[model samples]
Target: MSVPQAKSPPKAFDADSAQRALRLARETLQIEANALIALDQRLADGDHSIVQAVQLLLNCHGRVVVSGIGKSGHIARKIAATLASTGTPALFVHPAEAAHGDLGMITAHDVFIAISNSGEASELMSIGPIIKRMGAKLIAMTGNADSSLGELADVHLNTRVDKEACPLNLAPTASTTAALAMGDALAVAVLDARGFREEDFARSHPGGALGRRLLTHVRDVMRSGADIPAVSADTSLSAALEEITKKGMAMTAIVDVDGRVLGVFTDGDLRRLIEHVQDFTKLSIADVMHANPRTIEPQRLAVDAVAMMEEFRINQLLVADADGILVGALHIHDLTRAKVI
Candidate 1:
């Protein structure tokens, strides 16, 4: 038997190789960025297709049906999700599966957004006729405007790119980026047309921090009832200090006989008093308190409370009812712990 040749050793990693690798990666990013710039210029040059597609989606009475194959399918799913979260009802359906049985998901009042780089995906092409036959509007996102799927579409969005970021120019790099950008553009336009607000977005994302900040009311996250730190305005300074320590709040509310808040005494005020007064025992809580303190209503949003605290540079806020009676209290730490900050 002939002797096998010795296998060569693996090349050692060095600074030169690392530099070349980094340069290539940077070049790839720059090329993709340039593609986006070109797409932006094209849009600024008055590409009416994007606007027309947004109008079609806005006019859709039923849900939006987004369909694609392969990498385009992944991008299509993302587009569908974004549209759904931003107030537009949308879902992704695989074109191949649509041909199998998912076509039933499409309705006459729905709008179809089909994505394919070449505008010639056989799976999408197969469902194109069915979508049209069902009286659904078809919007095609493709690089080739003259391709079959483009010809069948009511609106053709041009997502063409001069080159792929891939060195071999075989992968869907720049094309997919352009397609995703176009989808985002359409979603934002429709969102603006429908006047979708942040509160509307928060409703769909109720489990998120933003939702908590927008939806949670001051009454929901406040220390109320016995937890409120308060003392009689005539209470001695020593007794007011005991109330603050017992209630575990840095401040205490001074209330009158009818339980209406007269003033507030805080740690900062205590510090200032110590600096100015020689005998703390002789002072009444009312004498050292800050009158007309900033207060928040129980019905306001927690985020508004945070804004108030930030604007007034106070760490705690007194929650009062319409009658100016102290109902609850909260600190910055409470908002931070609740993820409202």
Candidate 2:
């Protein structure tokens, strides 16, 4: 055994040192990128292993159990999360933990994925056979196909990298990158084959921004009842201005006796009216209101209202029914408050 001596601390971070750092970073990125390119090329070479793995996942009646050791465990957890969020039922169980009691998480109908760069992680290798005997199909992601884990797998995905990004070539850099890329490829392919939609992904991530955009409806954010600013068609323009100010929506909807939307009066229309007419106090609402205002249905998504507002270049919109009667109102601020903007 040899005791390695520690080196002195780094010098001041000057231009020369910055260049060295940049060069190393660029080389590391290029190496990892090359590894991904090689993985893609290998998959392109008439490899049905990935296809088989995807099929197994698609047909899985239970959750996909992913297990790995060391750095591979991190990648496996990410793969499990991606799969679960994209419509697949999946979870990560540490290989060592599975050897203890987590093995019960695996059922006969589930698909088990074991990731090991060298295909010889003792923990995973020990439990892999047990999971297979339990009737769960096994998929192996490894750099070595001849290793025991690969041999025990129903399908093997080769994640071999020619070399590592680490200058010593002993660190897990390129190998872990390749394994993660392959895992992502599998999850994406399975989700695509399963016809996963954005809304489905949102369902799995309801607290996320996409969930707010997809799951939130116009009715959920729109101002209804006393909150909606409205007036009759025959009302004076001065009175409509009061409704707009009272509602703080900067606009007012004009409906007929049947409560059907006929027009809209906005601050912009008011400004234009003021510029033209000096004393228009007696002006009727119908005379100044813009006819046929853009309207949206309450059942429509709040995101759709955002699109409508952007397209029409307006701030306020009337929520209407199939009969074109006003039900509620929406302002850009409402969407902002709901985090749907």
Candidate 3:
């Protein structure tokens, strides 16, 4: 009885397959990590020109205009978004389009952030004279500090990488990643310097999940008036059960004569009551209701409600006002529908 049965045959391992996957993943991650480290090294120790450039953007009453071409253009767009969301006003303007009419997007009070690998992109160079003539500060992000764009800038942010991550060594993989990281560093530095809070960021990202969770309150998603499943405490169990069934909610609130919540009864209660008590019509809902149920304040943020629901592992909650009178009810589904979860 103590003898152990032979272990099942060990799963086969293809060394070639495992090594190929691991090699690719490690190589890619190593390239990106190295590029980021190099970018970090280029940042000045303290309040320097690049730091001052970010400060300038933060202080500008106008917007930050970001421009680049090709892969750098894509990175510039993301950087602009990061800046805008983190409290610095910013928008992306394609270098080519700027030659037509997008240049109007850039005003004298705005700051210009231009990206180029060699610091000699033709499109960026074409708009250079105009940007300078407008008296807008030009902040350059490039690998070549001596190139035309760099020389024309008010501040230079070096995003140089020794080599490209692509096997051909001609693609802009490492350089773009470094540039993006450097851009992020600048935006976040400005954000921290300005003491930008989460609520501020949430305001900028109102359509996103974190924004909804932070800004949406219980009243924004609660079932109100006719939508709420509720009945008076003196109501018979059958009537209360009918209310819950008609509203399609798992539970119904039991209220007193003054419309104040007294208790709650759920599907679980119905099941238990049915098993032990058969006189549903004769029984009063108050006798079997759960008193002092968990509730949330109407003004509480949706994120707080999510936390409470997770902690209690419940799907619904009652919302009360400052006076503890029932205002509304909320279900977990409501949060998901509002994209607040």
Each prediction's total of clashing residue pairs, residues at least 3 apart in sequence or on different chains, is 0, 0, 0
Per-residue lDDT of model 3, residues 106-168, tens digit only:
888989999998999999999988999998989999998899999999898888888887878
Off by over 4 Å in 2: 1-8, 11-16
Relative to the true structure, candidate 3 reaches a TM of: 0.84
Q: Compared with the true structure, what per-residue lDDT tens digits does model 2 show for residues 119-150? A: 99999988988998899999999999999999
Q: In model 1, what is the error at residue 326, expressed in angstroms?
A: 1.3
Residue 235, model 3: Cα distance from true site in angstroms: 2.2
Q: Evaluate all candidate structures by whole-model CA lDDT and list the values in order.
A: 0.92, 0.93, 0.88
Over 184-258, each residue of candidate 1 has an lDDT whose tens digit, in order, gives: 989999999999999999999999988998899999889998999999988999999999889888999998988
lDDT of 3 at 110: 89
Name the best candidate (by TM-score).
Answer: 2
What are the root-mean-square deviations of the candidates from the true structure over C-alphas? 2.9, 2.3, 10.5
Report the Cα lDDT for candidate 3: 0.88
Q: Is candidate 2 or candidate 3 better by lDDT?
A: 2
Between prediction 1 and prediction 2, the one with superior TM-score is: 2
lDDT of 3 at 252: 95
TM-score of 2: 0.95
Error of 2 at 249 (Å): 1.0
TM-score of each: 0.93, 0.95, 0.84
